[model samples]
Target: MGSTRIAVVVASTGRPEELGRWKEHILRQTLQPSRFVFAVVKPSDLPSSDAMLPCAEVVYCNPGLPVQRNAALELLLGATHIIAFFDDDYVPSAYCLEGIVDFFQRHSAVVAVNGSLLADGINTAGIPYEEAIALVDANDRNGKPEAKVICSLDGLYGCNMVYRSAAIGAERFDENLPLYAWQEDIDFAARVGRRGGLALTTAFAGVHQGVKAARLAGVRLGYSQIANPVYLMRKGTLSFKAGIRLIARNLVMNHVRAFKPEPWIDRRGRCKGNWIGILDLVIGRDHPKNILSIRQ
Candidate 1:
């Protein structure tokens, strides 16, 4: 098996306490990564030192998910063969990296692998793994032995996915997707797949501590879920039918039912606005905005 140098990129905006927990989980991993990099958005917000963890590198960058991811990607580029993306709220299983390395080694054609996201069962703050599983698309079920499955265009969620550094090349998360909430992963995955890469989902998992979505300028940003997919679809990421299905599913199943009535109405309105944005994207009306600008 090839010696795959793994770089775990933890992108965060705030929550030093959660970072500490994540750090603990990383340090205890059975298959240690070559390097562990925590890319924090606002450095001043994090603890001055997480000295407990060895070989830990922390980077602070402008407060955007794409920008933070790009910063981590740049730092990790030449240093590792496989780069795994993990969010700040996640605490990975001890075997997460080991499973990734083994999967990649055994499945040479796989360009990316996604892990299951379990909710912390103890807290009212987090969604339980069972609940999270209920949220997955029925068609995108995981198979044994890391076999390739037909994933929907919207299948690649960012919370726990690994990418081949070489296949990614200089391509980074779309900077124009200013809102960190939604379709960036779908867009990135589509780009990778279109370029002859495959993304796989595995039973191996990680735990999300159930943090609320980050706020932008005191208001919780919902653009990614509301707008980004529409933008992505207009950009030709998904077929017309797939795009309609995604929007319908979000509107009927995920958004309206899950959110409060008032916020749901407001978010629905925003989603409507994105239809126009989608048209604009297609007809060349407004250029896409930078992802960093949307972060508070």
Candidate 2:
């Protein structure tokens, strides 16, 4: 990547303290980013006054993953050669940025790369911030194993995805998915990578705390579990088979777990939302944005 610069973007809400706690990771990166942008819904979404991070830019936007990210994107379009998006709770290895530059330099065919994850808490209760940092630190200390491209991917994972800014040109995250914008990454990556390729890479790795805070309402997320995939399938970003599997997997899990929902999850609410979404589909309304209309 030579003189070309890499910029980082983070779209976060209600995680001011988390960002404050993790800001030092920016200083630890082996190759610093030329730009670090944060997209927030409100002023308080940033770090507290006493704990402010230096050399970072903030952009305000309505509260939705796509909209926030797109807001940040506007600032970096022609200013950078590469752009990486990290979730607020993600802790990347010290050489993460170096790995990203290396991976891109070596793989000209890949348009986007999803960093490998040492641990992801989204599937379970969620990893503690300290635990996530410990994992990242251990990786940094023991040996920053050489980063390598791992596998092909249909969509870059949202927690830690990197792309060549030139490849992105006018592409943006889809705002129609709204709020948490479930599967929005798939939609965006599919569109952006149509000219090239998408891949998973070990050139960089991170721990995703998947902190439960600031998530969308259960009804909206559950509704997205159904409607979002269908919407993507119709738009041709998601295959019919893949979309059906996603919908079925969520519906089955919600059904089976509704009787004994995890403490961290709202299985009953999600199940109700799933049913509501299905009914809407039956009535010729399968739009993903419809979740916004479902009152709490």
Backbone clash numbers for all candidates listed: 2, 2
Put down candidate 1 lDDT per residue, 68-172, tens digits, no spaces. 888889899988999988776666666677778877776677677677554443224466434443543231243222433335333466777788888788678
Q: Give TM per candidate.
A: 0.75, 0.97
Q: Total clashes, candidate 1?
A: 2
List clashing residue pairs in candidate 1: 175-291, 178-291
Which candidate leads in TM-score?
Answer: 2
lDDT of 2 by residue, 1-296 (tens): 55869998988999997777646878888888899988899999999866666878999989999999999889899999999999998888998998899888889999899987999999789999889889998888866556577789988889999999988988889888998999999999999999799999879988999889888788878898989998999899999999999999999999999999998998888988899889988998888889889976
Whole-model Cα lDDT of every candidate shown, in order: 0.63, 0.88
Stretches off by above 4 angstroms in model 2 are none
Off by over 4 Å in 1: 48-52, 118-125, 128-155, 195-197, 201-203, 213-223, 252-296
Q: Give the range of the ten consecutive residues with the poorest summed lDDT in model 1.
A: 136-145
